[model samples]
Target: MAEAYPWQEALWQQLAGRTQHAHAYLLHGPQGIGKRALAERLMALLLCQRPKGLEACGECKSCLLLAAGSHPDNYVLEPEDTDKPIKVDQVRDLVSFIVQTAQLGGRKVVLIEPVEAMNINAANALLKSLEEPSGDTVLLLVSHQPSRLLPTIKSRCLQQACPLPGFEQSLAWLGKALPDSDEQERLELLTLAAGSPLAAVSLQAQGVREQRALVVDGVKKLLKQQSSPSQLAEAWSAVPLLLLFDWFCDWSNLVLRYQLTQDEEGLGLADMRKVVQYLAQKSSQGKVLEIQDWILVQRQKVLAKANLNRVLLLESLLVSWAMLTAQR
Candidate 1:
């Protein structure tokens, strides 16, 4: 296996070379922070017939098969379709695969990415396998939102936490990765990604920066009474609802912070400092908190598969935000 990220080295060291390995490991971390990469590296090391220290020997047959994506004992379970939940049948299949003997007479490894995507029934189905191991079996479950997982599921495995890198470290790594990007652009991307270096790089590559700017600008206009909620929603039709809601949630927190402290220090969103300050001054502390609460509730609804009218939801949030400064 190739080396994990620079920040992940210490954690990797702790996980490697244990006398007795757990039947399952839950690797929990924020999205785009290399949790999956770390899990993959560990998986390769576990399946390698001849591992050197914590890494796989690339010359081995097991390594070659894994690299070629044809390893007989390796199983990966994920949602069949994008944005869909993993079904119970999928977990059943994984359970069956786990009971089988390894083709190479070695350990069998099962990888489940974003385990939160598994619905309740699916999670319940996998619980038995997790509780009782059949053979030399290992399960690596990667989750970005571990809170959504069943507590019983979490308790059945040893958990490993992966944290975001420090700001300077993230910026430095991002600088080397995208040499052509200027410091300001890199910082902007980092801010947009909530300080996750890999997420920043991904957002930049996906042109989220441009879309984010449009949303922020539209928000500024809405707050200034220059744009209506419906108009802004229509203008931002291309932007995903979840992304917009998340951005609003972030901004709402900042507005509340400014209202409480009256200081802008350490408040991210460098490019929108002026707008954030303007909204902070004009908006009341209570109103900001109310809107923040509303955002949280709506975000949970969106995640819980609640049926919602997109345009109406967006308009409601925007209108509430625009009225934060209204005189009682």
Candidate 2:
């Protein structure tokens, strides 16, 4: 039984009150905002034989089956591999499931997470199912990038935006989730997660704090010319490529911010304030923007699943940063 976050309470209440739900719902929001949790909770609520308020009755057969991951009418579709495309065949199977009668004789639910991962063919295949879902069915499409979906698909479902919680809300949640973390550490983690509390929790669980420090230290060394790009890239090879690029992109933006404003107010890299200040003083705005643009290009390449040599990519990025240290 998935529980809703504090920020999701209002939405949960609203959804609970609705006796008649749309055939499909598109829960679109930024990544790490708990959309999937909300969707799963809703699925449980819909599937519960004896529902109580917005929650599922634990003793119900449906609830037990769902908990055991054998719910006959509840379907979840995702990419077969991480960061890969969901193919058309998966949607074809979902179509077959949709046509079948509900085993529990209650509402059927289908959940597709990060639906943007579906390629053009898969997206097209899903359009027909999304348009005309059979029986008492609810299709929940959870997307971090809804803009990538076809326009016709968007028009077929009710759009729900799950927004990031405010800083104070996030801080309170983090304090409870990570009680061992001090105030400063909580703030840093929350900032790194871009105000997403769940993402902050995940970062802590993955030991991102230690990895981040190493990456930051490596960047400092690179800027000081103490290490070469190839060496730093090899040292940080164990780190996830996307996460490393995201941090680098953030740092690049901070450098640009400092160059433009000559102040470090609200910078994401608060722990590296001195480094940001130093780079701001030494690097020209033009140079910083060039690096920022390059980072954006690299990020797009990664998102597009371009065939890239990981070491070479990181090496080139580091070399670019090192060169910027010499900018007048």
Best by lDDT: 1
Which digits, one per residue and each the tens of the lDDT, describe model 1 over residues 44-85?
A: 988999998777888799999999999999999988987788
Q: What is the lDDT of residue 66 in candidate 2?
A: 94
Runs with alpha carbons beyond 4 Å of true place in candidate 2: none
TM-score for candidate 2, residues paired by index: 0.94
Residue pairs in collision within model 2? none
TM-score of each: 0.96, 0.94
Residue ranges of candidate 1 with Cα displaced over 4 Å: 1-3
Q: Please list the Cα RMSD from the true structure of every candidate, rounded to 1 decimal place.
A: 1.4, 1.8
